[model samples]
Structure formats: structure tokens, C-alpha cells
Target: MKRFTLRTGIRWKITIAIAAVGALITLALSLVVHSAARVSMLESARETQLDRVQYISRNAEAGRKPPMGAKLNDPELPQELRDKARSGRRGTYVQEKPRGLPEVWAAVPLGNGQVLSLHSQFRESANMMRDLDRALAIGSLAVVIGGSALGVLIGGQISRRLRQAAAAAGKVALGDPDVRVRDAVGGVVRDETDDLARAVDAMADALQQRLEAERRVTADIAHELRTPVTGLLTAAELLPPGRPTELVRDRAQAMRVLVEDVLEVARLDSASERAELQDVALGEFVARRVSALMPEASVRIVADEIVSTDPRRLERILGNLLANAGRYGKPPVQVDVEGRVVRVRDHGPGFPEALLREGPSRFRTGSTDRAGVGHGLGLTIAEGQARVLGARLTFRNVAGPGGTDREGAAAGAVAVLWLPEHAPTTTGSFPVIGVP
Candidate 1:
């Protein structure tokens, strides 16, 4: 089963933030401006209407007909303004009609139990406001859109530079010595992203230099030890046969193996090692190797698919695993081959916490309260060889009735080797077998 997630990139996040802020600001300003404009326009209309009502009052006092749009004691005048006129106080009101322009009214007392009132529908102010509202709305939208576009431009540059730095770091981790981060503006170093790029490039350079020095020292030590170790082996062989002679031979052999392992590590570190690929019956190959290493171990062939890989490297990996299990792990060791995968298990204390977490490191044997521990080169060599074969090697502890708890030793350790299925292979399948 697979799960998928929707990942929102930094560019979109920044754009949305900027657009939202811009929209809020624009809305606030639009409301303020519209309120101020409407108030100013209505106030001006009220002043003009008051002047007309005063003129009509003077005309009635002079015994002449009132002007158009003006009436003495009009029935349609708003009650609030009419009450103010009856109390001898001038008043003004703005009426919002359902259709047409808004009506502005002004009233004055005539002192004869009558009132002079004038009204006008201020169409110019209403139309001006309608036009202003349209302009503000369009302007607000444009601001938000423009801000979003600017945000994308800036955010995209940052995101792209970060992706480049991340990709370069990944290649460096995968043992690519020549990868370097490139800044957005080539050599400018303009911003934090540029700084990050420069920092990554510097780190990669330092790492490559350190690794080269380490490999040189390892190769030098191994080459220096080869001659004397070989001479010592020859001398031990020529000595008289006894318990003392056997001890000398064994120690000398161990030293020779150590030197050879160091040399192999140097080669793998140099990144120039190549695999010799050939088709192999996986089950038969594994069976033979297992028999040679630990005759008492069991082998189970489940799929037995023929695979293409380097036989020498494959055998080296398996041999190291078998030797490690037999030395430190309690047996009933088992090897299971299924398709392009091989799993080796030992019913012993599982690998130490450090080993499982950090994988194998040269000369660092993660031994606990177990029987014995090796020099730690075996698993390291095995892992390097798997890399050369383009395969994945992983370690785990199997849980079951026999498995140990945290306070106790683990039940068993399992090492899995997953071979590449896309490798070229020959035509036939190998027979499955369960050997005890």
C-alpha cells in the first residue's frame, strides 16, 4: 500500500499570504473613502436645499408665488423635519427613495402656522458615488493580483535556489565528489539562499578533501603491512609443527586478513571499483556459499529466480554475514532466498542499537553482552560490496516468542540483501529447495 500527500510549495504559500493582506488593506481603505465621499456630497446638497427654502420663505412674505420645487406647508415633507419647523427651528433630512436619486429636504418656519420646505433629488452626487464605487472595486482587485504576482516572482527564486542546494547535498551524500551548489545569480551571493548555496559548496569541498586523505592513509598502511605479513606467514609455515607454531600461524593469518580488508576498503572508497556482471542461479549459488561457510546452517529457497550480478562480490557479502552470525550470534542460522532477495538470520542477541541505527562502520564493533565480537571490517566490507553490485543491504531484529526484550538480549538478527531486478538475466529458473 502506498500513501500520497499534497505538498504546498513555498512559492504558493507566500503568494497567498501577500494576496490576503493586500485584499484586507484595500477593503479597509475603500470603506473609509466611500464613507467620507458620501458624507461630503450629502452635506453640500443639504446646504443648497436650505438656501432654496429660505428664498421661498422671503417670497411668501412679499406676497409672491413660491419658486418651483418649493412648497408652503407641503404634505409630503418628512415628519421629523416638519416637527422641527413647527418648533421654530430650521431642519434638514436626506430621504433614501426606492427608485431614482436620493431626496434631500430642508425646512423653515413661516411664523403663520405654516412651513416653507424645498426638496431635490441630487442625481449628480448619486451617479458620482456609483462611479467611485466601481473604480475602487476594480482598483482593489488589481492590487491583490499585482501583489500576488510579485510574491510569486520573489518566492520562486528562493524556492529554486533551495532545491538546487538540496539536490547537491543529496549527491554528496551518495558519494559524488564533484557536486557543487550553484547560486541563483552565478557568483553574486545576493541573499540568504545564495549564502546557503555557498555554504553547501564549501562543505562538499571539505568533505571530499577529508575522505581523500583518509583513503590515502588506509592504502598506505595496508601496502606497508603486506610484505612483512606475507614474510611472517612464510616463516610460520616453515617452523616445526606444535601448539606454539599453530598459534603463530593463526595470529599471522588474522593480521593478513586485516590488511587485505583495509586495502579493499580503500578501493571502494576511491569510487573506481567496478562489478563483473554475470547470470547466476541464486539458490544454487547461495547454497554452495552457505555450505562452505557454515555447514550446519539451514537454507530455504522460495523463489530461486536467476539474477545478474557479480558472483564474487555476492559471495563475499554472504560469507561475511555467515561468519559474523556464527561468531557473535547463537545459531540455528538460516538463509532464505526469494527472487532477487536474500535474507540471513541468526537466533542471537540482535545487532546493538548503534549498529542498527548508524549501519556498519569500519573498526567500530557494536558488541554487547554477547559471546564474541569481530574486528567490524566484515560487515563494512559486505555493505561496500553490495553498493558496488547496486544492491541494498539492511539489518533488523525479528520479533517472536524467542525474541529478547529491551532489558534482555534480542531474539535474532536478520540481514536482507535486495538485488536489482532490472539487471540482465539468462532464461531459466532455478529449482526451489528447503535444506536443513
Candidate 2:
């Protein structure tokens, strides 16, 4: 099964969160401001209307002409206000006018059977409220935008630190334990991200130390056993030809192979190991390798491109792969060469999940089906040798439940070795090491 994670970046997530909060706050403030402004403007207009109409009522009571804007029982005045005035109470009403300011009316009883009323459009208060609303809208928009930009700035800093730490961790996983996140980021733990970087750096340091110790131990043990295993093989060969003699020789040979593989693994781990490159016809090379290591395997050449590589190291890698196929996979192993890429496939139950997910691990057969055919160093040795050659090696299940299969072949595991197209500028030579 395959799994995936969301691709959205932390910057976008942070920006969205902050902008949403800012938008909500701005919306709330705008509501409160709009309501407060509307209420205050209406109240002020009502007070002005009431004062003018009352003054006009007093002037008409003395039989003086009212002001121009004031009227005596104007027909256009609201009937509700007129009725209230006739009943000896002051009344006020507001009428909405589309596309313009509101008309405010106030009526007062004159005590002479005539009602006095005054009205005017509240243009100044309306314009003030309109301007206030516009300002609030613009201010809200600005707050949201500014919040988003601030989030981006903050998120970018955090995301960059996290990405660096993650990349360093990935390099460590790929066997480069020297990568230190603290070097890329600051060493000081200023925040959570810095703390993470520090943790990654510490882990890399610890892993590097542990791996170096392990390599030293492995190399020492293998070198110590090499001479004894060689003597044991020689001693077994001198025995009389019998079943017991054959068994002794076979056991000694197995020990020698194991010791040699361990030593080879140690050499591959060293930084001093270098590839001696030369032009090699990939198709012909693969054919020879398959014949020598696994004669039952079939080879197909799609393109006979010449690749510059160390043939000895390439043979070691291919030998391990072929050995693994014969031991753990079913019959009809297939090797295909196309350009600089070589694929080795086997028709058997696909590789275990652990091997597929994490490549090969030392001393781990990865399946109960291994049946003790090897010491579980074949794939690991192959991978290390490939790395020394500056080549890429990948493992996958190309057939069966985990993958698609060839037209008539059963599901199985596939390992691909891809060599660089051209020779490296400098091919440093090291002592030739044989594969077990």
C-alpha cells in the first residue's frame, strides 16, 4: 500500500489562519461601528428636527410667519406625527429616501387647532455615516491583507528552518551522517524550529559516531578471520576425497565467502573507496555477468549503450543480485539492459514490505522464506558497491500484488542499477576487492 501527505505549505496554512481571524475581527468591528454610527446620526437628526418644529409652533402661536423650512400642517408630513401633535404631544418621524439622505419630520401642537411641523434631509449626518462606512470597509480590508503578509513573513522563516532540518535528516537516512542541520540554521535554540534543528544535528552526530564504530568492528573482525578461513580451506582440500571431506571443504568455503563479504562491505563503507572507470558495453557486460553468476537467468538487450564504470565493482553488484535472485526468488530470473540502466527481475513472491520500504538491511533476510541460503548480506553488499561506483541502485516489486507483472511472468521483485552516462573526470583507483 501507498500513502501520501497534504502538499500545502506551512506558509499558506499560516497565512490562511491569520487572515481568517483578522477577517472575523474586522467583520465584528464593522458591524459595531455601522450600528453605532447609524444610531448616533439618527438621534442627532431627531433632536434638530424637534427643536426647529417647536420654535415654529411658538411663532405661529403669536400669529407671526413661520420659517421657510417650517410649515403649518404640511400635507407631506407623516399622519402619525400629525395625529400625535393633535393629541397635544410632540411627535417625530423619519422617512427613508432612495439614493439620497433621509427626511426627518417633527410636529408640535400650536393650541390653535393648527399643527406645526418641520422637515429637512439629514445630508450632513448621512454623508458622515457614508464616509465612516467606507473607511471601515477599507480599514477591514487592509487589516486582513496586512495580517496575511505578516503571516507569510513569519511562516517563511519557520518553514525554511524546518525544511533545512528535514533535508538534513533525509541525508542522514541516506547514510550521510555528517549532515548537520545546525550548520544550515543557527545552532542556538531560539524557538521550536531551532530546537528541532539542534535535535537533528545531535542525532546526526550520534549516528556518525555509532556507524564509524560499527565499521571499525566489522573491518577488524573480518580481517582477523580472513587468514584463519584461508588456512581452513587449504587444510580441508588436503583431506581424502569423501562425503565428510566434501562437507568440511564446503563449510570452510562458506566461512571464507562470509569473511570476504564482510571485508568488502567494510571497504565500501570507507570514504577512500573509489571507482576505476572504463568504457563498458552494457549489454555484453550484463550477458557475461549473468552467465558467470546465474547461468539459468535470461538477458535481453534493448539498447547496447556503452557506459563508463568500474566493471569489477559492477560485477560484484550484479553477482550479489543474481545470487539473491537464485536463492530467494523463483525460476526464470530476467535481466534487461537498456542504455545505461540494467534491471534484474525474478518471478517469485515479491519482496517483503520492510525491504521494499527501507532497501536492504545487514543480517536481515526480510522473509521467513529465505531458508538459510545466505547470511543476508547480498543486497546490502550490492547496494554499498553500487554507491562506491557512483551509480544508483533501487529496489521494487514490479509484479504481483505490489506491482504490475510482465505479460506472462508472475509477480516478483526487481532491482535496477543505473550507471552514469559518461566517465567521471577523475577515477581514483583502489585495491581490487572480490565479491564472496
Each prediction's TM-score versus the true structure: 0.82, 0.84
Candidate 1 per-residue lDDT, tens place, 167-273, comes to 87787787866666763235344777777777877877888889999999999999999999999999999999999999999999999999999999999888777
Worst 10 residues of 2 by lDDT: 401-410
User: 1-436 in candidate 2: lDDT tens per residue?
Assistant: 6798778999999999999999999999999989998888888889988987887777788889998989887899888888898899998899888777789988888888888888888889878888999999999999999999999998888888788878877776766645678776663447887777787778678877888899999999999999999999999989999999999998999899999989888877765577778888889999998998888899999999978888898998999898888888888899999988999998876676778788888888876654355677889989987877767899887555434433323377788998865444454423355789
Model 2, which residues run further than 4 Å from truth? 1-6, 67-69, 73-91, 95-102, 187-189, 270-272, 368-370, 398-410, 420-436
Q: Candidate 1: where are CA atoms >4 Å away? A: 1-7, 51-103, 109-114, 119-135, 183-190, 370-372, 402-405, 422-436
> In order, what lDDT does every prediction score?
0.87, 0.83
RMSD of 2: 5.7
Clashing pairs in 2: 399-411
lDDT of 2 at 290: 90
